[model samples]
Target: MDGGFVYGGSGLSTIDGKGRCTIPSDLRSTVEASSNGNVVCLARHPDLPCLMGFGTTERDALVTDLKKQWEYAQQRGENFDRQAAGGPLASSLTVIGFEASGRFVVPPMLRFFGKLEEQAFFHGNITNFYIWNPSILLAQETGFEMQKEIAEYFLAEAERKRK
Candidate 1:
């Protein structure tokens, strides 16, 4: 993917009873550009409590990266468990389509994995963005200070809107 198609910025969206949430505008535009459509690939983040989302371009890149890793391991005469290596990226991936308004239904398994509920806090991370349960994000410790701050800001904005 081109650097211009990177995901960035942050926002919040309410999850309705049907599990629908609107992707933030900036992130949505990036997804459309990188995917060539409104489809997104979502999966449980390998090391985070949130879910990670990306366009088809990133998904293809993951395949390329895995191939490179396998080749590197073969050259060193090391055994590479292809299944173990690609499981996280491929196993739970779910492809979803959104409307022009950016609303999409979060699959049940992904919703559970992400611990999402009433609201989702979106934080962009260059190649992909994270969809976090607001409370889960706020409760996180250590290296997530910036993400926590962004979640808080959006939470506060939502609160203000309600007032």
Candidate 2:
């Protein structure tokens, strides 16, 4: 699959010395459904060290949504525009073919970002696939929960202020 798509899930797999990792057998069927495994996009997401996966279908739709959102932000003002534009995102990975062995070549930059080694987590996040170092994934999960606590604190404060 090499177009816009959407999917999300957790499937355990390992990356070989050659930087190839396999999708779980169950997931393989989904990949096969795509034109070319839907050109899996594995990338890091904001506030998480985990990998996010998107099928080719979701990926294309995301771009459209982002563009619309960006435009809406611009209408709001420079502050909104700045917020949307001030981030480095890895949304431009291409789908490299998979081997008969079921291993796929992950990009070097993505590999480093993911800190991938022998074992990694493969996630299908509806717009792409994310490859994450398992430890990083754990840390990310913990950090996200902590962030929710902080956000709750702020929300409570806002409620008090409103009163």
Candidate 3:
């Protein structure tokens, strides 16, 4: 990639019959830089109707964070079973390697959950990217009416950061 390739941008892509989709070049570069080789990790977002991708370093950090959260809940008298809470997150996580051509396949279950068929949408979110089924993503938006909501959120976040 040319220097200064920005990380956060949105784009569209299509999945082949084999469930392979090419990672956007900039995103791919970032993933490769952080990962040991072409391997990247995939996991279900705990709450969102989307998947999360992580490089080696990112995955380690995430595991640490989850452990901390589990411990915090334990101290708060919440009956969060450590293994029970961590098992799903751990089991759902898989490491995948990009093909020589920069394509990676989403596993079958993730594909079904993502509802990704012929087309997929890629939205870069700084450290990682979100692969979304276009229809599902669009359904979450309020169309043109989202402008007010977006602006309010942007302003509120900007103000909060200023404090």
Candidate 4:
């Protein structure tokens, strides 16, 4: 799939008890443009610090890639130590699907990570995204920027955006 979808900048949004957040207008546009109007939320685990929102096309491509990698490893007799490593991105991912209306749910554990008090930010991470609490993003003191190579490496919506 063509990842030419331009990632709009990040913005603040609120989360409800059910963990739903409204897609920022620009983000919606970015999602609509690339996804042909559909989007999905992805989480590595409820214990993770951030969440990812992805376009369906990217999601599918990632799943396919992951499965291929897993298969190759299996064929090569990659050891249990190696098998203990990575799996299908789907296996690595947990997600919430969304409708065209622009509201999506975050997993309960993810919501707890930020003590999510209604506001969060959606930052693009090239192949995926970061759904973060505003305070968490601000609390970071590291001079390093995440995904420095993301924008150049792929059709990332925003590779990584930080203050």
Candidate 5:
């Protein structure tokens, strides 16, 4: 979350028949460093039609932020349901382990939620990265111009490779 392990760069990967895809090299190295291993925590974006991926450190930061929010609400005499606040965050994330080669399985629910098909586009956001179904990303009408352009470029590149 600070000086180390910033998620940056973007790439595209093809989903294999078994619902597995390889994380791009630059992103994968940062994930390994931040998590101290080959595990990545994945969850559906709370507001988007994509999957969010991060390491343990980012996950810890999210938990700490939630606690701070609860305390602030308590100080204001507002009733904070900690369980309700944390339920979606806790239940949505799934821990996935990748091989050293950076290949990992995509959980079926996440895959469906993300609308992933043959290809996924990866985009970095410093603390985390988004895994997008390329067409779905391009279909987004608001914001994400840079991400959409990148996804389009990758989709073009993949098409070129096939011919």
Candidate 6:
């Protein structure tokens, strides 16, 4: 549960028909260092259109937070959102192992949920990384365009925050 894992970087990888892909070496090493043995947890991203990859430390922290929420809800006599919490934590998590060559198979269900084809785009976000279908990640129809309007809006937002 030490906080030394640095999951950052972006790259593209191939996902074969059977959902097997080779983890990028740098990312593989990072996960290997923090995970128990060679196992990494995979889940469908709750909000984003991607797969969430977690190391042991981050996964432990997530479970801790969920436990706290459960305790709070119980004390207050409030309904616990077990579906929201346990959906990803228990039901949907695809626990998989990394091979000596850093190859791993994405569970069929996860691959389908991610809409993964032949390629996946990996974007690291500190504690975890997103495994995105290249088509989905690049599709502008999803409002992910990076033209002038959105860029300027983000710039103005940053400026406003700076003050």
Which candidate tops TM-score? 1
Ranking the candidates on lDDT from highest down gives: 1, 5, 6, 3, 4, 2
Tens digit of lDDT per residue, candidate 1, span 1-163?
5435689988999999999999999899999988999999999999889999999889888888889999999999999987899998687899999999889999989999999999999989999999999898888777889889888888998999999
Candidate 6 residue lDDT tens string, 48-156: 7778887877788878878889999999999898568767546667778989777899888898888888876666667887787766766636553542243345345
User: Candidate 5, after superposition: displacement of residue 146 in Å?
Assistant: 0.9
Candidate order (TM-score): 1, 5, 6, 3, 4, 2
Residue 139 deviation, candidate 2, in Å? Answer: 4.6
TM-score of each: 0.96, 0.62, 0.72, 0.63, 0.94, 0.76
* Model 3, span 1-163: residue lDDT tens: 2223234554556689999987766677777777857987877767667676767777776667778888898889787666776776677788999975668888998887677887666666666667776656656654423423433443456458669
Writing each residue's lDDT as its tens digit, candidate 2 over 1-163 gives: 3353344444556578788777654445455555355345555566455555544555465566667787886787744453344344445345556654446777776677667777666555454556667555555534445434433454456458669
Give the winner by lDDT: 3 or 6. Answer: 6
TM-score of candidate 3 versus the correct structure, residues matched by position: 0.72
Q: Write out the backbone clash pairs for model 4.
A: 14-118, 126-156
For residue 155, model 1's alpha carbon misses the true position, in angstroms, by 0.8
User: Residue 117, candidate 1: how far off, in angstroms?
Assistant: 0.4
Off by over 4 Å in 5: none
Comparing 2 with 4 on TM-score, the higher-scoring candidate is: 4
TM-score of 2: 0.62
lDDT of 4: 0.59
Give per-model CA RMSD: 1.2, 12.5, 10.1, 7.6, 1.3, 9.1
Q: Is candidate 4 or 6 superior in lDDT?
A: 6
lDDT of 4 by residue, 71-107 (tens): 7878898743333444423444654556676787866
Q: What would you estimate as the lDDT of candidate 2?
A: 0.56
User: Which is the winner by TM-score between candidate 1 and candidate 3?
Assistant: 1
Best candidate, lDDT-wise? 1
